[model samples]
Target: MKKRIVSLAMAACLVLSMMVTLSACGGKPTLEEYYNSDAMQTIITAAVSQYEAQGVECSVTASGDELRYDFTIDIQTTEEERAIYAETLESQMPADYQEFIDEAKSIKESVSNETVTVVVTYYDADANVLYTQSYSSDG
Candidate 1:
């Protein structure tokens, strides 16, 4: 069984009733043709740079497009020592883990081998308050 390396945010995705309301006024590049490149270093650098500006610790797991792309991101620490935070979350993340698993199962049910774009960001103070975003091909 592939222990899908789900991102920390994805693992804490318990906001079923809390939906992100984005009023897409149309402008961002289409998922289809936007990230279809092999310049992973460039792409990752950009994402990391943008996030780092906001005082974030980041790591881009993978990158590509319809053919290949990132699937998971591991969150290390927020602002201070990660050891303490990780220890605390490890004990309290069970329920969140279950919810995250359920969410991944749903995504698996709905998605195919379709390449996905994912970015996982953990808040410096709150491990549960992670920012995870996924992008699918331009269908």
Candidate 2:
């Protein structure tokens, strides 16, 4: 009976250790870490400079396994200009980071005469979008 009890305890300890290891491996990237990464910030700065926009702002939020990127650019742009800007933004994404944009689960873009907003969100593992919102000068 004592031998059986000792074996059970050993099993429990093994299970607990496995749980801790899995939790550590499951750690997701934080918004701040993503935003501050040199690769990500460089792409944003490049887009802002290419468009000659006033400024570019970025935010990242996560819920469970979902990750979202919200970018706002201040610029006076017409409908046509907005389209071009969007293209330029995509092009500015670094080769190594293109997967982030390409694999986005949902992409939402909004443009007005004075401001442009782009929100690209995706699941952490598969890059699936949950929600999207976009606007244009025509609307």
Candidate 3:
């Protein structure tokens, strides 16, 4: 009777271990799933609100693993001004740019192992492209 009880207990333990292992192997989310998740939407909404509060119209979208940010400035500017803006961006990214990138990478890593690409485009009031920047997690 004692041997039978021990064998049954071992069998139960084995079954439980197998169940745990199988559940853990459920697989990571696809890029589309990550983008369409409520968490991603919340992040996008917050970003839009932050930029809008600063008088810039901002919209964010995701296609595959690429996240795009479109910002429209309220005022029109000359070609010289656009050139200067682009030069400044090339020299130094925005104060919060690295922070934003880190956050995005963290979120992406949590959901999938795929690379995440971020594209930011700035536009004037007339929808003229001012400056554009791209970043990739693979870097």
Per-residue alpha-carbon lDDT of candidate 2 for residues 25-115, written as tens digits (9 for 90 to 100): 6642343443344544554445435334444454455332334565555445555665565566556554525445432321111101122
Off-target runs (Cα >4 Å) in candidate 1 are 1-80, 114-139
* Candidate 2 C-alpha RMSD relative to the actual structure: 19.0
What ordering of candidates by lDDT runs from best to worst?
3, 2, 1
Each model's lDDT: 0.38, 0.41, 0.70
The TM-scores, one per candidate, come to 0.30, 0.33, 0.69
lDDT for position 110 in model 3: 47
TM-score between candidate 3 and the true structure: 0.69
Clashing pairs in 1: none
Candidate 3 structure quality by residue, lDDT tens digits, 88-109: 7667767757855875575466
Point out the worst 10-residue segment of candidate 2 by lDDT: 105-114
Evaluated with TM-score, which candidate comes out highest? 3
Clashes of 1: 0
